[model samples]
Target: AHGVARPAAPLSTFLVGFAAARNGGTAADIEQACATATGLALEWAKTHPTETR
Candidate 1:
């Protein structure tokens, strides 16, 4: 997991949820998107720390 700041983590998840909704995301879509985003976050954290929380 990216080291997202505790205070901002849930708020940021809303953005991700909105994105999933905008894309007509079903449960599968949400899962896939979340996985992708999480993977990217972990990768970015290795260098630039993309998480706010």
Candidate 2:
């Protein structure tokens, strides 16, 4: 979300936690959620790239 919006960082983290909690809040759940979020973010960054300024 670098080229997107400043609020996306916190919002994305909140969403990852929310997803983990909804799935049971176990270690595995948290890991899965983080991995999923990170993977998506990476893919998005690939297409979006970082902001110039």
Candidate 3:
């Protein structure tokens, strides 16, 4: 398995996406990451921006 655990892969991917969004990465990258994490399309996230703390 090349020393990689399949179960952990999704977590890693989710982190990358969250980091990208938090860091204000390009709209496309942020959207893709959010979509992957929520299973909802990027368009949905766009309509529901997170409130700033």
Model 1 ranges off by over 4 Å: 49-53
Residue 19 miss distance in model 1 (angstroms): 1.2
lDDT of each: 0.74, 0.88, 0.63
Better of 1 and 2 by lDDT: 2
Q: What's the CA error at residue 30 for candidate 1, in Å?
A: 0.5
* Candidate 3 Cα lDDT to native: 0.63
* Best candidate (score: lDDT): 2
lDDT tens digits, residues 1-53, model 2?
A: 55557788899889999999999999999999999998987888789767675
Error of 2 at 42 (Å): 0.4
Worst 10 residues of 1 by lDDT: 44-53
Question: Tell me, what's the RMSD of every candidate?
Answer: 4.1, 2.2, 13.5
> What TM-score, to 2 decimals, does candidate 2 have?
0.79
> Residue 13's C-alpha lDDT in candidate 1?
84
TM-score of each: 0.67, 0.79, 0.43
Q: Tens-digit lDDT track for model 1 on 2-36? A: 27557777876887798788878799778877887
TM-score for predicted model 3 compared with the true structure: 0.43
The per-residue C-alpha lDDT of model 3 at residue 30 equals 81
| Candidate 3 lDDT tens digits, 1-53 | 12344685678676967778777788887876766655543455477665556
